[model samples]
Target: MPTLDPTQLETLVVIAEEGTFDAAARRLHITPSAVSQRIRALERAAGQVLVRRTTPCTPTEAGEPLIRQGRQLRLLLAEAAATLKTGDTDDTVVDLSVVVNADTLATWFRPVLDEVATWDRTALRITVEDQGYSADALRRGEVLAAVTSEPKPVQGCTVEPLGRLRYTPGATPALVERYRKGRGIDWSAMPMIVYNEKDHLQDEVLAAHRATRPPVVHRVPSSHDFHEAIRRGLGWGMLLDAQAEADLASRTTIPLPGAKPIDIQLFWQRWRLDSIALDDLSEAVRRAARSGLRPTRPL
Candidate 1:
């Protein structure tokens, strides 16, 4: 079995996260050439090609697994070091890594920091991912907890039911009139805004009705920008109800037929170990979810 090289994995993780050799080198406080050489050496040591040296570099399949593990390893090491330091008189803080979706991050997620003002001794390190993808980070052990759309538990992680976040298909009245023209959804011909290629809600809505995929797909990556784009009549998109409610009430927005509601159930998945920081965060998140989310039937 090959022994893991912490330095090499660490370098790869940094490069993947930062997306540039020079940026990663600066982050590591090393020269660009040294960074490049180290990465090359790491690829050799692992006996696998890792990062692709392209613009806004991307990791190969082999690279992703190790890079994720590297982040988790660093977090665990930090926790262990903190535990050891706590034996001394010096004050120590535990570093906890967490994953969360961007929309929830933009919505009810950040309040946990202020909500847990009591836990001054601990510091949380967060990694933001999409709700649809955050669960993968939990499976990889890249984070202790995640705000995810998946209710299923990852191996060795305990699952806790949070609540549902509802998204609705909404569009501005002017945009609706122009596009619909007193008509209805046309799968192939309509222009639609989507949350990148990974987002399939719009396509799913059309397909469920046996419609063809829209030829003109406008990609808006940010949740905020996506809402703005739809409101501006640029395209139709699935907007969170909380985001579009005001517009809907003011007659600024309209929901498309056959696309009344799209609900995304979110869950809390975390390590089974008893950690004060984790417990506190979980409680706050659950409370927020219950307050805002639609009451769910057992799932």
Candidate 2:
């Protein structure tokens, strides 16, 4: 079996995180030339092009396992330090990078993170992506875990049902008035709000209503702004139930009739490892989801 040099493996992981040889060298407190040499030697030992020479460098298929190994080693070292009561400082804190969707970030995800705050030895680095594409971040090794809509686990990750987030078609009273004035909502001609180009909820709602044409979508990427846009009558869009709470009570927004709300089933995807921090964080998230979301229904 081929053995990887520890220094070379660490170099690969740092380069992947820092995105360039110079940046990796700066992080490791070495010359950029030394970083290059270490990577070259590592590639020779592996007998493959481990790192793709891109603008912001990325790992090849052969490099992923080594990168993961490097991460695992760091975690183990942190665990050992914590166990030994050694002179480990805050520098030993584990940084857990996770990907989550915008809606979750705005609503239920915050309270879950409060649990993570109790772990003084760990810090979370969060990446926001659409629920539909979050698993791709995990597959690419960009994050340690993710909240994704996909039930299928990524290559080395374990997946479990979190719960469902319901989204209802919502519009301002003014927009509703306009919609009701017509014989029916001319959805194709009406202005609509969407999170971004990647958002499909609006189109799905339109399809469910049998509206054949696409609307003039107003893209509001920020979650707060997206809600505000609809609240201010920019366009009609689906609002997550939690978000719709205030609007529903105030009668500022009304649900469009004849359309069933979209219930997005979410799942937790994380590495199938026995790290204490990961385990604790996952349990906290699961607990929060159980309390905040609808239970996942059996198919």
Candidate 3:
């Protein structure tokens, strides 16, 4: 069996996190030459070029296993420290990294953070991205867990159904009057707002409306801003149920009649580790999802 030096593994993890040799050295409080030497020694042990010399350094295929192992080891060490230092004043914080979607982050994910506050010995680092893409971060070992649309577990991870987020097609009354004046839509003249280039909710809505292409589009990447853009009559977009509450009640944004909401099924994927902190975080998230999102059939 090939043995790894813990110091060298730590060096690799730092380099991958920092994204540059000099940055890794500064983070580790070591000389850049020392960082380079350790990485080279690791490569010699692995018998492959682990990291690519790209701008903002990326891990090669061979490096991924080492990176994942290093992160898991760190999680175990933190859990062990918390176990040994069991005292009221024990300031040992378990650092957790997780990936979540922007929409959920804007909605139910907030409540999960509130739940975490009750567990004073844990600290979180969250990455917000699209639901369809968050699992990629987990697969790359950038995060230990993720809330994603993907049901398939990332190789070493376990996955379970959370719930579903429903999006309704919404528009300001003025825009609705402008484009949907009569029996049919003036599709070519109506501009639409989207979360980003990756957002397909608008397209799905348009297709259901029997239009092939969007007339015009305004991209608002932030969830709150995206809702605001629609409310301000910049363009109509799909709004989450919670986000559209005030507007729907006030009739400021009218729902597109007969349009079915796009239901996005969400799943929780996490490394199958025995750490209590990770298990607690998952339970909190699951509870929030159950209360907030529409129930879906179990996978």
Candidate 2 segments exceeding 4 Å error: 88-90, 181-183, 212-215
* Per-model TM values vs. the true structure: 0.73, 0.94, 0.94
Clashing residue pairs, backbone N/CA/C < 3 A, model 1: none
lDDT of 1 by residue, 1-299 (tens): 46778887888888877889999999999988988888888788778888998988878877867776676666556556666666662465655678887677667665676676666557777887877888887765457788887878887678877777788877777766665634575556668898776787777787776877767889888878888898888878888876788887887778875566777888898877655556777888788877767777674
The per-prediction tally of clashing pairs is 0, 0, 0
Candidate 3 on 89-112: residue-level lDDT in tens? Answer: 387778789999888998988889
lDDT, each prediction: 0.76, 0.86, 0.87
Alpha-carbon RMSD to native, per candidate: 4.6, 1.8, 2.2
Candidates 1 and 2, the one with greater lDDT? 2
| Ranked by lDDT, top first | 3, 2, 1
Q: How close is candidate 1 to the true structure, as a TM-score?
A: 0.73
Q: In candidate 1, which residue ranges exceed 4 Å CA deviation?
A: 1-91, 116-118, 181-183
| Model 2 Cα lDDT, one tens digit per residue, 192-234 | 8889888998889778767754446789999988988989999
